[model samples]
Target: MSESKKILVPLLIALIIVSAFVSGCVDESSTSQSIQPQEEAVTEAETVTETTTEDVTEKETITVTDSLGRVVEVPKNPESVICSGAGGTRYLTYLQAQDKIVALDSTEDKVSVGKAYAIANSYFEGYPTFGQSGSENLEVIVSLDPQPEVIFTMYTTNGYDPDELQDKTGIPVIALKEGDMVQNREDMYQILRIMGEVMGKEDRAEEVISFMDATIADLNERTEDVSDAQKITCYAGGVGSAGSYDLMSTDSYYPPLYFINAKNVAYDPAAPKVAKVSKESILIWAPEVIFIELRPSQFEGENYAPYQLENDVSLNQLSAVQNEKVYGMLPYKFYSHNPDTALVDSYYTGTILYPDEFEDIVLEDKAAEIYGFLVCEGDVEKGMSVYETMLTISSTPVFTSLEFD
Candidate 1:
């Protein structure tokens, strides 16, 4: 309890502390180093976990087999895409996915009015164009703001190489066939399904397919009972393919004719799908009912074939010309064979070939219904307005040839 005892006790405590450090029993620096590594280990573990999660997010995608048979991995439910070839945009429009279109081919911007899908989505005129029809400008595709995730191209030919396109744009590209509404119906449906699968619209794809199926079935059933003897021999001429052609341009197997049970007088087992019939050949196999496509030139007063029919007295010798059986069908081959117009053409042809069966139908109403369901998702109000807009660009199917008024 004295001053000397207090000093001795403090000196003894200091020595004990120094001796513990000298013996390395409580090495503070070693303990500090050990705690630092544990902290770093926890930080490293967190960094690894964060990086793994990011990799999974970056790789999230779905695999699709395009019409070209190319397997591609695309981002799940891509919100933006480019429809790049002939009927590529049309198929997307048919699936009611027109909103997904980020850019279009310049051809659509130029020929916006005539193509049915183009007509339905006229606002597309304002969207950036990727390139010309059947050909895409990869530079523009890649430079698009908010870059597109996928590209749907049709008719892979005409200078469009899907593989090269996909490579250059770094965007997944899907190629498709311009399959017809008839014989190759399944191919067309399959293309829609593939796209729908990629876009997460599988149900919509099936809905569109079922509508087409029901349409084809309805057309066939309506004319099913027409006796082969009673079925009129008909011909479709002035058909558009690649570009406009003269009156003699026709397609054998002329898809819609088969659906309506018309014995196409031009139906050739050996001829190319599209053939140029001679004026002389026409005289020998005169078709009783003639359906014609009003080419774009015709609207511009070129009157390519119709001028020949009305003025070429030699052609007047044909029954179709003389009896007024020649009718104007919608330009079904705009861009590609427009399935909606094909069906409308078939129905109109049916009214002429067998009116009693189509007596309950109104052509305008039916046309609107077709456009509404196929292009507008069964929204007839929108379909009705679109139909009116369509009339400005295309002839209403029905009426003697060249009589759009």
Candidate 2:
């Protein structure tokens, strides 16, 4: 073969190998470009899945029916809560679920003296104040660091709609019907039951109900046989509007009166639940026994009902004052009816009215038992101390006897 022919054949083979190598490189580059978009798409899909899962986790909720018959979606396990109206905090404290309370109404925080709950749960004093009772501050509530999951309030208040409140605060608002505790006890029970369900303290709620039931039954059994002639005509003074004090104010259906079967001079079918009667009417009624409901304001002032009764010229003529049948009782209706304190008042009223029926009872011991069961943390002695403190601060006679001449 010629030299030129040999060189041309080798060059052609080299050129063919180069062409194949370049084609392989081009194919690899195209493949890398195609795989990159697919990898990015997979990463984006994963990110979306994570975000959706987080949203679902954050939005978990459950349905509840409030006392006003409004259905609402609330947190499954509410970690933070606020009691927004009068006596609203009382319910939470009664349930022993005040640990979950993140904020309080201004009235609850502002009042230095009142109900055993406030005295017992000192921690509540430090909680942030959302607003005054019946008038919550929407901006302050929304600005809470760990936002409250729910808001509890009374159904009877005007201009406070649960739906509107929930919408404004982005929190569930539950309105409970807190009727007259003496006249409508079942309503109170229902309120407790609903609170128990919402607060995850159903068992504790049942325990309280049982205590109240047993106490009422025991009280009734002792006094059931007493004749109408034996029943003492009584009047509860200083039964002012919630959270205030007025000497002439009285309850038409005081629990102590109902429990002990006493005749309430203020009880009139036509009268409002709480009524203000004149001194002339009081003279006409001439109650045999008078119970002065000690108020917090009276603690610092000289206008306490007992002192007023003692000094009043017209009141001195009444049999209760003249015969010294006047007694002092812890304010049963401060903020609202304190069922526990009212129960304690019942025992005192019963013992005074029918000494023979309650001869075995001791007032301080009995008060301790009720307070321990209802308020104290299983410490009967502490309960007694709290009760004594209440009496002392209010300037009330702890255990005055009606048999005194």
Per-candidate TM vs. native?
0.82, 0.81
lDDT of each: 0.78, 0.79
Clashing pairs in 1: none
Candidate 1 segments exceeding 4 Å error: 1-56, 297-303, 394-405
lDDT of 2 by residue, 1-405 (tens): 999999999999999999999999999999999999999999999999999987785746777787888887788668888887777777777788888888888877655454788877878878888886557789999999788888888775566677888889888898888876666788888778878888888888898889899898898899888888868788888775753355578888778877777778888866777877787888898998888776554343445566567667887778887788887777788777788888898998888888899999998899888887677866898788777776764544555632222
Task: For residues 1-405, write the lDDT of model 1, one tens digit per residue.
Answer: 999999999999999989987878557777988999999999999999999987785646999988878899999988899887678788888888889888887777667655667778878879988787456677788889879998888755567588877887788888877677766788888888998998888999998888888888898888888798977788888787666555788888676687887888888777776778887877788889778776554443333566667667777778888877788766777777788878777787888888888898788888889989988778888877776666665443434454321
Clashing pairs in 2: none
Residue 52 lDDT in candidate 2: 92
Q: What stretches of model 2 exceed 4 Å from their correct place?
A: 1-56, 242-244, 297-304, 401-405
lDDT for residue 115 in candidate 1, whole number 0-100: 67
